[model samples]
Target: MSINLEGFVRRKTKLKLGGKEWIFNELSLADFARLRAKMAKERKVNLAERRKQLIEEAKGIGDIDPLKLLEHLDKPVTDEEMDAEMESIEGVGYMAYLSLKYAYPEVTEEDALKMLSIDKIEVVVGAMMGGLSGDKKKPKAKAKPV
Candidate 1:
């Protein structure tokens, strides 16, 4: 029997082949690997164009070390650590990070957070918000009828 994996709880308890109850906390290495590989395959099935765009954005960053960035993101990094790591990368900003993330898919929330911390990302967001503010528009005065 198959259970809906997307739900909070798994429905099926027994594996037909092993004739044993399948427990989340007690999954074997092979079973876990199989599940992970299935998820990864699903994620990449139709993302070629998006992946290309992310690669282009990374290329524009010049020397930010994509592999290391991916590694850093895969493992959790502290906010302070992120600040120190990105401090010296020229033109690396919040907007650029967002663009990069938009183009490429992240496997975890930590990776998503790392993309948000880019300097260009902040500048781009600020500009976008600034343009939407209505504070600069003045109210028109009403004329009295004679």
Candidate 2:
């Protein structure tokens, strides 16, 4: 017998951003991975572009300790760094696009742009990252019939 899981679900929210209300749904694991992949791709491109320059700049340094140079390379990024990166314009836009795409699969690129703006991107990012919780309406206490 299969058990029902209908009661377990993330909240869908309706909030104003860019002077308009857009309903947003929680990002699925795949959706979140896509955003992370976008950022990782950018980081890879930057490192590739700077590889030659970095090597040339480091030339003539007698003793090279590769371990010391890349010791923290494998370390995971800190939460603060991730937060700061998401706050950037590119990150904010991509995040907003992903959020919208997840919420509305039929959303167009033009509409996605319209959904996010400079003044409200932070709020949108915050909501997506769980920095703000007031977006969800609170339920009132049930009263007993007298």
Candidate 3:
């Protein structure tokens, strides 16, 4: 058998947000799937009807499972739409919740939502994406033999 060492373990890092330190875990496949599922559910997009439309347009496209194609159909999303989704309760809010809960197991999703306000969300999410919160201070040189 073969084993790929890459991403063998979940990455954990400390991120400062809202003037507090938080441990952020790399989003595992399961976590990503959960995030996407929640967003899809809360966004209330009519995927089923859209899927039906696609299947109709794809009539006689050979021996394929038309019903299965429904799984892949979704409205062509716009950047604006995506940005809106990211700010919604089920969007980045949910992601922040998920990321936070991994660190403080007791934190409820409600608590996570309360933690991020409109003003702080951008900073927290930006840090979560990779920034370290503050700039590094340069070290001073030491005296030779004082």
Candidate that would win on TM-score: 2
Superposing all C-alpha atoms, what RMSD in Å does each candidate have to the true structure?
A: 20.9, 5.8, 8.3
- The full ranking of all candidates by TM-score, starting with the best, is 2, 3, 1
lDDT per residue for candidate 2 within 41-120, as digits (tens), equals 66666765465555554565747644454443434555676678766776666666777775678886567666676766
TM-score of each: 0.23, 0.62, 0.49
Clashing pairs in 2: none
Candidate 3 colliding pairs, count: 0
Off by over 4 Å in 2: 1-8, 16-20, 28-30, 60-78, 108-114, 126-146
Of 1 and 2, the candidate ahead on lDDT is 2
| Model 1, span 15-82: residue lDDT tens | 11123222111223443344344434544564555556556777898876656544533433344543
Query: What does candidate 3 score on TM?
Result: 0.49
Among all candidates shown, the one with the greatest lDDT: 3
Cand. 3 Cα-lDDT:
0.65
Candidate 3: where are CA atoms >4 Å away?
Answer: 1-20, 43-83, 132-146
* Per-model CA lDDT versus the true structure: 0.38, 0.64, 0.65
Worst 10 residues of 1 by lDDT: 9-18
Task: Look at candidate 1 and tell me the lDDT of residue 128.
Answer: 24
